[model samples]
Target: MTRETLDRQLHHIQDEILLLGSLVEQAMLNAVQSLKNRDRAAAHKIYQADQDINEKRFAIENAILILMATQQPMARDLRMLAAMLEVNTELERMGDYAKGIAKVTQRLGDVEIKIPIQEIEQMASIATSMLHRALGCFISENAMVASQIPAEDDQVDRLYEEIYRQIVHTMIENPDLIDHTNLLLWVAHNLERMADRVTNICERTVFINTGELLEMDTTDDEEELDSE
Candidate 1:
């Protein structure tokens, strides 16, 4: 392919990645809303949308692979291709987390139990926001913004901790709510994991911009600081 054609294909792949990001964000939102509102139809919708997310991801990956094989991209172009592949995988996994939350919702069924899901909702909010910003950084190739995105994961982690402790206490206080609380905890865990996948996308953004495969292990540093 010509240079212009190659660049156009790369841009197309980037656009598809952004599209997938938006779908995953919607899935996360719907999954959380389904849980919060006890809407089975909404939960099922997320599960169905996950199929589209998976299909789109594979299509983009195949396009990138073909471009790489036929064009023999230079170092910079190769970096972008590699970043796209990694980010595509992360986005797909985030979609899976959303599906996982949907499954939890299905398991909950029509139980009229009222347990506070506000913290899980907060976790989902932060995670989806991180995902949105990460995609923007990816599209803009902004290493600085990408580098800062993982820091927000710290807030998600804290919310996860709070949810975990609260759920455990609730389960302890009311053994009957053990199943309900456990399911909600799993939902929170899925949202937390989705945020972690967004960090992976941010790392890919940094890699594409700087051509450096740096591991942004901020959680370890945060733990140490907490200990100190």
Candidate 2:
């Protein structure tokens, strides 16, 4: 393929990745909203829509592989295509986390457990925002911006801990609600994990730009500072 044609195909694939990101972002937000509202129908819709996320993921994968095979992308272009592949996988996993939240909502049924809705919503909000910025950094090849996004995962972690403590306290107060409370904890865990995966996408952005595979761990940074 000519350079012009290759560039065009690359742009098309990037657009697909953005579309996939938007879908997963919506799924994450909708899943939590469904839980807050106790809307089983909405939760079920999110679960079913996971199939569409899966399909989009594979479609992006197929396109990338075809480009690699036919275009024989070299150096920076090859790194980019490879990073896109990884980002595509990470986005699909985030979609699964969303689906997992929806599943938890379904399992809760009609149980009247006291959910930490505010904290949970806050976690989702921060996570989706991180994801949005991560994708933007990826498209711009802005390693500087990508480097800063993972630090926001610290906020997600603190919220997850607060949610966990609240749930545990509630479970202890009412032993009978253990099962229902555990499901709520699972939802928080899903959101936390989704935010962690966004850091991985950020790592990919840095990789594509500098050819360096850095882990970007904020927790470790904190530990080092404390030791110093």
Number of the predicted model whose lDDT against the real structure is largest: 2
Residue 206 of model 1 has an lDDT of 84
lDDT of 1 at 40: 87
Give per-residue CA lDDT, model 1, range 35-132, as digits (tens). 88888899899978999999999999999999999989988899999889989999999999999999988898987665458888888889999999
Note the Cα lDDT for every prediction shown.
0.87, 0.93
Q: Give residue 166's error in model 1 in angstroms.
A: 1.5
Model 2, residue 153: C-alpha shift (Å): 0.7
lDDT of 2: 0.93
Off by over 4 Å in 2: 221-228
Candidates' RMSD to native = 2.3, 2.8
What would the TM-scores of all predictions be? 0.93, 0.95
